[model samples]
Target chain A: MWRDAALVAGKDLRVEGRAKVAVNQVAPYALVVLLLFGFAFDQDRPLLVQAAPGLFWMAVLFSGLLAVQRSFSIESADGAIDALRLSRLEPAGIFIGKVVAVAAQLVVLEALLAFGVVVLFQSRLGGAGLLVASTLVSTAGVAAAGVAYGALCVGLRARETLLPLLLSPVLAPVVLAATEAWRAALGLSRGDGWRWLGILACFAAIYLAGGAIGFGALIEET
Target chain B: MSSSSSLTRALGISALAAVAVNAWWGLSLSPPDKVQGQLVRILYVHPAVATMCYAGFGLCALGSICWLWPRTRSPRWDRLAVAGAEVGAVFCAATLITGSIWGKAAWGVWWTWDARLTLTAILFALSLGYLALRRAVDNPHSRALMSSAVALLMALTVVLDHYATAWFATLHQHTTLFKPSPSIHGWQLVTMCWSFVALGLVFAWMVVHRYRLEALEERYESEGYLVAIEARRAEGQPVSAAARPETGRVLVGSAASAERAEALVEDK
Candidate 1:
């Protein structure tokens, strides 16, 4: 099952490698969103520093969502999911593999957005250690939850609207904790951000377990 | 897994009664607070929704586990668990929205991504998405099974959301519902308790209703297929007798299409 899932995961990566769509499509959107966000803030340096993590994650989150939502849609659009199901690969493995792919996309988007925030807001980049950690932890969470959810709602009516509505509420905690952790890591406040990191860690665990159990059933449905 | 004929109807009536009872205590009977007064009245719907959301999340986890067991694939066990998930998600939405209203009244903010509040919102979104996934899918058995897993995964987010502050410096306040009262204590507590019973009844009713629909739809489709297959068999080939009216519908609920019925025929 693990090997099969790895193959599925690898296939996802290969597809993206060929198309270069995630970075090509989603990255520009994130950048434009960031530029617009900076423009709206009226050039307040201290204020922007305080809000930078939020703005960064906001873009990452929405962009991450766009990326995650498509993971299942791509397969389902062409009846690829039907073939995947018939292939006799374990559904849980498929779920995990897709999560890895989406997680990778999220990481790329976050890195690019982080760079943009650093340049546009002129925020301190001295806390590279924490910034990297925060982004990685949060991205893990986004990938896990997105795969499970992506599997479930991919076939629903009004899927586009439904995806965000359903995901935002559930994903909000990871967003809150990780973004705060990233902000704190960036030197937003001296107050400890370890608590947020712990929450992100916990979110990742829950998602992993959830994927194991939920992905099985979701595969049957898909 | 099947409810007796009268029992299903009785449960249905009981659910309606619960809604009425909760409405009275929550809306009219509970004494208005002397301090926060009517603003405190918001307490009625708030606790009900929050607890219901928790229960729904619990069911999501349970559904995931059950889906792994082949026996649960039967419409009987499968529909019951899925029903719990759908109702649970609905309550989760109630929890987030009502909590926000309460937050706005108490904190002067419409939305705060606090650890607990934000988590609750995420939970609601997850449940809604879970339901949407169910609708989007074309298969029946697979739909129930996959949703079971999605519910479980989504519920896992609750643990993170709950403990988010342990990792970050969250402005989101810790739970105040359980805090020892400084004033208006006992009476306020009583109102909350009463509201709980009322809401619990409603939750039970919601599950029963959704479950019935699931069963009926399951039965209607299966029976429809049985009818088709029986026709096939009557034409001199072998097929399952699920098409016969003697069994009625094995699962329940009304179906919009026979594709699902056809899917079951393929399985059998």
Candidate 2:
């Protein structure tokens, strides 16, 4: 299953590499969100620094929507979904693969957005290792959740509007936990970073298992 | 249908009696609290409606799980899920409204980011999303499948949010209603108990009516599908085997024609 997942992930990444939609459009859009947050706060440096963790994750969450949409839109064209159904690949593998591909895109988007915050908002990063670990784990949880819901609305008329509504609330735990973890990493508050990390890890595990188990039911055009 | 109508009628009478008794006992007979005074009146409505809200979503999740399991999967489960979610949404709205009113009287704000308040808001959004999802999909089976999966996910999120809320300290009081050693006594407790009975019956009545509404809509859609399929046959179009009505889904082409047929029928 891991091998099949890798193969599917590789295929999706290759397609993304060729299209560069995520890199060219979504990454820049994430930067714009950073700017929007700055202006929303009236460009107060202290306020921006204070809210950097949440703003960064919000940017990641918003960009993730596009990445997940693109991931499924590739298959929404032609008879691509039917082709996958006939491919004999494990449904769990496909789910993991999509999640992996989306996570990779989100990680890169997050990295760039983190940099943007450092420069634009002058927010200092204190615990680098904890920060990166939290980012990767939280990205996985968001990716799994996003892909699980993204595939659900594919090929529907209101999918574009419905996907965000379905996904955003489910991501509340991730946003809260990840922001707390980031706060701890940045030394903003005397919070237990490990506990927040544990929450993020549990979220990733639940979504990964859920997507793998439930993907088959979702993929079929019942 | 006759039995269900009679059952609803019985429920209506019981609900009325329960509401009347609770109102009289709670508003006039019950002594004012030493602390909150008249403000305590909101408790009778708020806590009971909030409990019913949670119960509605619990029922929705149970229905969704049953529908997901192959052995027990049925349209009735799907209908139950929809009914539960719709009624849950209504109760959820009521909870938010009454809670806000109480908050203003007690906390001096229309809203606060209290743990229970935030969780209830998220649940309200989730219920609305579930209903919106049902409206977006045209196919009954697909709608059922997708919404069932979503309902399960929403249920899990609710649990996680509950824990997360508890994990983080906030203004929302704990160990009140669900405590082993009860908090209040006398007419307050009695009225609260009576409110629960009234709200529970009202919830059951709403779910029954909503479920019947869904069944009628399903019947009308199926009839529309048959009409559309017959029209396609007359046009000599080759429909796929998958377009069979037995599958409980209308093909896209047939769905469009069905909309037209439904419109035409309405015109007649």
Candidate 3:
């Protein structure tokens, strides 16, 4: 299972690497979202700094949608989904691989957005340990759920619109917890960031297990 | 079928009577709350509607699980699943509306990030997604499987979401109605419990009707496909060409002819 997962992960990542869509498009779109937040907040320095954590995670959540869509869109093109099914890689492995690939892209996106938060919002970064832990767990939660849902909608004609509508509400808890954790890490809120990290971990575990167990059935029909 | 339809009619009548009595008892018969005064009346309707909302989703999850299990898989279970989800989504919307109104009256705000309110809103979205998925997938088997997967997912997320939101922020009052000692007594309690019975009957009636409608629709779809296939066969089309996999509509030669046939069928 681990070998299959790694192979699938490698294939997805290699596809993403060659395509450069995440880099050229999603990353800039995320940065632009941060800038737009600046505009929405009227460039209010204090408010922008205060809202940085939420704005940052919201950008990640949106970009994660694009990453998951791209991952499955690759499969749907040229009958690759049938090929993947026939390839005999375990469904759990495929699920984890998609999660890993999307999480990897999201990690990079988060790093870029973290920098944007600092530069654009003038937000100070403090708790490094909390920041890293929360990012890893929350990204896993978001990516696992996103990949599971992406596979569910892959065969639909209206997937482009349906994916976001279906996925965003499911990811609400992750966004809420991650934002709280980041706010604490950035010294913007007085809440315990570590406690929020624990919630993020719980969200990640439930989705990872749920996706792994259910992905096989989900994709069988799709 | 006659017995079940009779049962549904009986249920509908009982539900209407019970709701009427409960409304009168709650609005005018019961004394005003010492704390909330006249605004306390919202409790009778809001709590019952919210309970029905959860009950509907719980039924959906049960149907989904039964369908997912290989031993119990059936179109009946799928029908129940969709019926439960559709009815649940309606009650969920009502729950939000009633809860919002109560919140505005009591808390001076139309909405809040409280645990219960947020969770209901999320559940509402999940159900809408499930319905959208049902519409998007053309294959019946795929639709059942995919929507069942989504229903189970929503069940799992509801558990996680409950805890996540509870810890995030908890402004809603804890379970006051279902406590051991209970918070209210006498007429208010009677009225509230009666409201549950009333709304629960209504929920039952709606789900039974919806389930029946779904079963009939499935029959009609399969029968329509058969009729279309038979029509094509009479026209000397090959069986293989007449029976397309995704949609059963017969295709004659070019795309333009296909569209024309489709339009003719639509007109008829």
Docking tier of model 3: it is medium
Over 4 Å off in model 2, which ranges?
Answer: B1-4, B160-168, B229-268
For residues B1-268, write the lDDT of model 2, one tens digit per residue.
Answer: 2326777889888888888887888889888888989987887898889778878888899999999889999999998999999998899999999989998888899999766688788888888889999999898889999999889866865674456446768775554556687788888878877788888888888888888888888887888778676767623433344554532254556555545555665677
The regions of model 3 sitting more than 4 angstroms off are B1-4, B157-169, B237-268
Ranking by DockQ: 3, 2, 1
Order the candidates by TM-score, highest first. 3, 2, 1
Candidate 1 local lDDT, A42-110, one digit each (tens): 898888878888888889888978888768778877888888888888877888788888988888788
TM-score of each: 0.74, 0.89, 0.91
Runs off by more than 4 Å, candidate 1: A1-14, A42-46, A69-105, A148-167, A205-221, B1-35, B56-64, B71-73, B97-101, B157-191, B224-268
**Order of quality (lDDT):** 3, 2, 1
Error of 3 at A83 (Å): 0.7
Q: Give one digit per residue, the lDDT tens place, for model 2 in A1-222.
A: 898899999999999999999888999999999999999999688878989999999988889988988998898889688888889999999999999999998888887998999999999988988898999999999999998898788868888899889888888879989999999999998999989999899999998998899898788852
Worst 10 residues of 3 chain A by lDDT: A213-222
TM-score of chain A of 1: 0.95
